[model samples]
Target: MTALLLIDIQSGLQETVYYGTERSNPQAEENCHKILEVFRNKDLPVFHVMHNSTNPASPLYPGKKGNAFHPLVQPIDEEPIFQKTVNSAFIGTNLEIAMISRNITHLVIVGLTIEHCISTSVRMAANLGFHVTLISDATAAFDKIGYDGIRYSAEVIHQTELANLKDEFAQIQDTVTFLTELDN
Candidate 1:
């Protein structure tokens, strides 16, 4: 069966000031909500992955308001929530075991910062033999600075990361196309 995996779509990641970076895709959360609606309507399995940063000064620190899940993609009762301090959700969590227990073979992944936790989780999911579909429009990325002091725009970083993951780790699709496919 297919399952929806939402990674690190927490309030902390929504603030660009916390990361000292600008983010692209202002409508990413909206798109994620749409995708989430489809998953719920279809009665598919849904899993939420939260990042709890170990850094004391980080916005994602435990007990902080920023550590809470975004309202748009908040989990309802019975939906499994996995917490991790690392980028890959499966590393310190029981995500893989949960998927196995439910016989979930396909994963539709969405959430924050395309080049970070999203990228890591997608790669690991594919390597573990699950079919992954990454919704491009349902994810966003923050601008990054290179070691040589070059700054890359969030749009460029987002697109580049998607390109890297395309066809290799996951099948990249936009929210519209994925919803359309689900409709039919």
Candidate 2:
């Protein structure tokens, strides 16, 4: 079975990490919505991986209002949701068990903060021998200041992250291309 693992597509992350409310890439939310729609239409299992932080003020902290999934990528009634505190979803969560139970072999990855959580999950998925296809257009990150004290735009950071993962940890593809083939 093919499963779509949406990592950290939370409201707080979207607003903070991906600049969801900003004037940049206005189509980002639309792209995410299209991804969700296509995945749902295929009857694929949609797994929502949320990062839960211990800090109450952190966006991902459990029970915090911002801990909720992003509205654009909200789960359907039958979809499964998993909360993880660690960077890798398989580490502190039942993701592997659930995948094994479902006989899932191919994982379609999407969502926020490409440099950290998303990157870790993709690498781990590849290490665990799962065929991972990352929808490049569907995943995004925010501008980050470098250790060298250089500031990078969200797209620049996202491109570097994608470059590191593509053809190594995952096969990066456009969301529309993936959905088109699957829809056919």
Which candidate tops TM-score? 1
Q: Could you tell me the TM-score of candidate 2?
A: 0.89
Best by lDDT: 1
lDDT of candidate 2 over 59-113, digit per residue (tens): 7788877789888888877888888887888888889999989999999888776
Candidate 1 per-residue lDDT over residues 90-117, each given as its tens digit = 9999999999999999999999878999
Q: Please report, in order, the local distance difference test score of every candidate based on alpha carbons.
A: 0.93, 0.81
Give each prediction's root-mean-square deviation over alpha carbons.
Answer: 0.8, 2.5
**Residue 9 displacement in candidate 2 (angstroms):** 0.9
Residue 104, model 1: lDDT of: 96
Candidate 2, superposed: residue stretches over 4 Å from native: 17-26
With a 3 Å backbone cut-off (N, CA, C), the pairs that clash in candidate 1 are none
lDDT of 2: 0.81
